[model samples]
Target chain A: MYVQRNRSLSIRSRRDPPANRHRFSISTFRGMQQPELSRKMGKMIKSENSAIGAYEAAGRERSSIAAQLSDWGESTDDDTVSDISDKLGVMLAEMGELEDVFAQNLEDYRGVLKQIRNMESSVQPSREQRQKVTDEISKLKYKDPTSARLETLEHELVRAEAQNLVAEAQLSNITRQKLKEAFDIHLAAVVERSEKQTIIARHARRLLTFIDDSPVVPGDARPAYDHETEARQVLEDAENDLRGWAPSVEPIPTSAGQESRVNGVEHDSDGLTTGLGSATGAGVSQPMTNGGPSAKKQLEEPQSQSQTEAEPIAY
Target chain B: MYVQRNRSLSIRSRRDPPANRHRFSISTFRGMQQPELSRKMGKMIKSENSAIGAYEAAGRERSSIAAQLSDWGESTDDDTVSDISDKLGVMLAEMGELEDVFAQNLEDYRGVLKQIRNMESSVQPSREQRQKVTDEISKLKYKDPTSARLETLEHELVRAEAQNLVAEAQLSNITRQKLKEAFDIHLAAVVERSEKQTIIARHARRLLTFIDDSPVVPGDARPAYDHETEARQVLEDAENDLRGWAPSVEPIPTSAGQESRVNGVEHDSDGLTTGLGSATGAGVSQPMTNGGPSAKKQLEEPQSQSQTEAEPIAY
Candidate 1:
């Protein structure tokens, strides 16, 4: 029972720089090819995918372990261990279910982040176009002061600058708005998970108390386990708590009003939404709703399991 | 924004029997090789390893994502987003560190289970020995009624029965005691993780509020980002809350007093603690102390980072 616990932060955290995680992989090469303006957000979006996958994997493993635990308990042939472990298995499985739900919430958050990355990717080309035309006009002026092509190039530069201006504005607006929306869902999911899991784990501890660890001598038999009713009650309490659970997070406010978006376009002569993909200020003109249904929506939604099942141990 | 969430319990839960997870793997073959008495606990211990590994992988990914987030924000060139994202990264990295600690705690719980498995494995041989002797004596009587080998085998049967009885008692005592001890650490770890993450996540939500998600017009600049003081305060608050955090779980009681173990031996005429390996009642008779420094000990331990560091963003 000599356990060497990892008391310090992991060595991997200290030695491996987080900025260059999995840098040699094919995905990293794709990331490297991204336009400079969009590179960082692109990388963050991809890393978020890995983060979500890890959570999904963790949830799957947790559920598998829960079932194995109950099966092991039944095999023990000891009545008390069998009953308590089976009940503990039920609680653990619920915890696994929570992990899966949390991962789903994170996936929503990841999608919101993708909006920003997509906007970044679109904006990069406009920025390059503006820079290219500006460079050409300057070069013509220096090389041939009287060249008629200089006037045409100057006009093209104005058009490119106007397009780039709209793109830049869309990028800034979407980036700020989506970033807030994403983490709002993310942090709320975190709090929801912590609260619900605390409720389950607390009840789970009660199940542990039912196990009588008193030792017995050779030939002495343990008394019959009669805690079945009490153990079953623990599962009932957990289910009720989960069913009653609600989001207790603070409301994250936003000011992305309709005026700043659509009016910003109609009022500004250069802020034409034409020529840009639908990504340009598409939703900005609308009133800021809780984008992508906040974690609160999921909590308020009814659970899939039937409320009429009187027995807690249906499985 | 169409989020098709897994609101229902996963389909895998309904169709895939928990009893046969990964049954075709090489590890499953190893599990099958275990003696019948120890097989179930053996499988359980292995599943716990996968569960712990999943958490470790999750922790690593989370920390990586946190750094990437901060890097992405810094590249945005918006002072407010940059400062807030960096602080948010710090909180997230802390959460990741908690996952690693939780995984470590599970490893301790897994170690405790191995003790029960080892005891079960040792006891299996004794049970087989007794059964073999009884069979031999019966077969000899049926085949050759006058065989002198029957008397020697009967004496061997008595000796085997005595050894087996001791072995059975040891198995039950160790199983119950260690099962309680193992989950005591485990459930406590769950509670510890839930409570601490709630603290960090609440503070992280505060960081999110500092993000000015107000949209801007085309060519209109955002106000100079100015939430630095408030943002840094959130980190300090989180660190302070974490440092002050403690275990508030209900204490699980154990009746594994010294008398039931040692006196159960001294008082029983048949309870000779011999023949079995030291696994038999070695430490059972000793006073029952908390096993493997429950989650409380780790909570009390000082963190690796120095309290004297005034700057929160040293990295």
Candidate 2:
């Protein structure tokens, strides 16, 4: 066998991109562009890989925080501290969801890649069949001194063409565009999910610091008011005043709202129960607010008030 | 065109993983176990894709925060607010670094995939050539296709075998294990980096809240006393006594460290101001220890004061 060891059924790419990748044509694969596409897609693959690792790490970090709460002597009987810890528990669960999403994102990415490999390999058998038919055609043309078989050779040519077409059809099965759609779609979702998750982590941090640095004792009888709630209301009222911005979700934290928020709050101020919300000072003054997205905007409390404010003061 | 339209070069997979994936036996390509492998690798690809999305999101989120800082009024002067704003700027820079790393990771992942596709495609030419040779040998068996032709056919079979060996060698160029190794290495690094970043975000949150909640006095000649500095040191010393741990880094925030922190502190306490360092307290504390890597451990403070303490007093 005079083996042509490197015959290929290659796809070509041009700068303009194929009009339709799945609809295979002679021009569909301009050359071999998977290398370039794969190289570009590599960033997506690596990013998802990072996310999986980060999600798992974040879960472990949150768990360590739970341990920290115990080590820091977070009085379990103190409703405020315990409340924050419970909310942290909820954030931890959200991290678990993020991990699952990350896993799915990875699967979808590799799934498309493996499909590409399989489709590319599909060319081998067709090329082999063509070679065999070509040889049969050649045999039919050869005479062993007397009998040449042109009919059989013509038949074999037909077979060869059929095999070639089969290979071409498989090439039509996928396009570069389709591969990106399959994989990159999930990537966008995961990215959005991750930023949301970081906010949850921020909430967890605020809750931890508030519980840790607070000097006020938990009220024995009366329900101690959390200034974060009142401040958020004031901010919402301010937002309505500033831009007529109606909050998409109600800003009020009902007792059930606090209990049921598995993913924590979109805003971090909900977790800050410290006098940071409403410090009355100098002349028992009020709060301060500057302009920005109220999500990150926080009001200033008078230092003189934060200084001598009653611990666990009612809003 | 009597095309066998749906003929497939499919790999057959039993539940038990086709013996070994790397052993390039003829049976290695049996029917095609691609669906199974694709199903498994899908997770990996999806994960990488998600990471890419998340890395971008994180970068964008950091940029938005920078915008928020500006919008919230980062004046050049106010030392306290501007100091926190400057630290936020450093964090934004770190986010940029993370985005770059994510891009590199994506490229590596896609590079491996493209290589795999290229290697798999290499099988086509050899298989086609072998088919042609086999047909030529068949033709040589005609009436006067004599012993001489048989000798030629025998030689051709040997060449076919050589081509088969080449195809097998091509198979060895890529293995499932190699793909995993190529893509998974960065995942570990990325994960560790993310958790470290969460801690960064935590510190950023604390600094922000500290600035936002404090009165906007640009320290007009009278030394500004931060109640938080006192409270945090007291907590640290309390923790030190509780764990019999000595402070590895000073908890007091020196303005010098702020001017100097290229990579922030190992412990948050080390970043606290010195004035809050030695607040005498009534100590009612007992120590607790737990076994773990203890990445954030502090060395012990003197235990003489922790035996009897008041609970929640102002500095």
Candidate 3:
């Protein structure tokens, strides 16, 4: 819409009460103090005040009548009351409209206050006064519209409005019930998800219980074998074997043959049996007295042993 | 307060010009003409209209004066204009009060309209009128105070009000700049979080790129023995091994050694080797007679050959 000029017709945001208000005169500023409008304003204020008082009296009467309807005695009946109820419904609508008018009127007057301020500060009697408000605004480090903080805040407001514009609009029309229904619906979804989670937890518990805690297989057969002990033995053997495989920081002579010479436990025959004598490998095929063609056969023969005594001799 | 019964004071919300108004006697309802409230309402209306007109005229005069100031030749000066500005400010405030009065007046008349409707339909001749609003409320399908929807709505409104009570209070004295500052602080937080997420993503990308593309293992020296691949291969192979070990849905014959006999694909020799006899048994110790005591030894010897020529006999 086309507006008057550089300024839109709106109130200047800061305003005090009317007791210190202006007289709307250019002649007074030019040395002629005009008091003509004062009488007019006074008369308006008086009439409006009376109108307000009368309006309030009327409202009190209506409310009083509504309160006393049940005491209307013999005249009160369903049909008559119903007919009046229709009119009451209309009155309620009018009441709502009246409330809106009050709010609108408040806004309009506030606008006028802002308008006066706008004219007071911006309408310069000379060219220099145009810069007055800008200078005043710049003095305020925080409230200045061009401040970095305000710029950042504007970005934030834009994002927030983008997200919650619907919510704000909804708020205007929102009755308590719509808000309840919306939240209750979400609550129900949460409850449903919780219920499913509870079912999942219940099933998991039942599944864990279904598996028996028993000593069964070291491969399903060696059930009689002490598999845990055997496993421990295998771990010990692997650890010892790994240590024998490489020198950590420097070149060192092989250790497996030394183990054989010292511990007398050489039984592996085909591979992983004896060392090649240096840091690297062309692995030696050591001989087994048990006559197994392969070292793996030799390893297996000892793994089946029931006692720890037989474990180190070959494994 | 006691009122003039059916003529309880008010201006009709849709009141026409003062030349025409109420026709309020009971016989008038049956079309007999009556004009009871013209005098009282007329005076109120006349005074209010005059006030409203005066307010507008003052505003127009101020606008006109501001427009004419530059042309006031040598007569206009800042101090003189400042004096008039003061007066304009007062007028602006008065205008605002006048707006409020208008709203109050409207409310008063709406109340009178309700009072008149109440007395006409429900009041007895010898007594004051009783309010029947609650009785009307109880009869409404949607408006009944006890309705579940209304209850839920009320609950929601209460919750919303409670949550927003701080916001409502803060807004009353809040300046635009203050609002901007508060929101700007929040925006900074959002920007910080976004920055953190960017850092997190950058670090994750760098970490993923750290490992070189080339393989670290020399698998040729250790054919059938990729330690890292063996780890992952062990995982894959173990999955396959387990599948081979268990019956899919029924109690069936064991399969490890059986695959060797049936598909002739015998290769692996872990503790998973089997005997297929009954409900349960000792694990299989099937003999390998292709000149290798250990199937693993046989498998490796063939894998080193790599030509795909010796695959069947060894594998």
Best by DockQ: 1
Worst 10 residues of 2 chain B by lDDT: B276-285
Over A23-80, each residue of candidate 3 has an lDDT whose tens digit, in order, gives 4423344323212312222233223333333333333333333333213211323232
True contacts kept of each: 0.70, 0.00, 0.00
lDDT of 2 at B166: 35
DockQ of 3: 0.01
Writing each residue's lDDT as its tens digit, candidate 1 over A13-55 gives 4444547445532333544466777678767766766666666
lDDT tens digits, residue span B212-256, model 3: 111111111111212333233333443353345321111111111
Q: What share of the true interface contacts does candidate 2 keep?
A: 0.00
Which tens-of-lDDT digit does each residue in B195-279 have in candidate 2?
4443344333334333322112211132352645633543344334434522121121111111111111121211111111111
User: Could you give candidate 1's per-residue lDDT for residues B35-73 as a string of tens digits?
Assistant: 887778777776777778777777887888899989988
Docking quality level of the chain pair in candidate 2: incorrect
Which candidate leads the pack in lDDT? 1
Give the TM-score ranking, best first.
1, 2, 3
The prediction achieving the highest TM-score against the true structure is 1
Residue B74 lDDT (model 3):
17
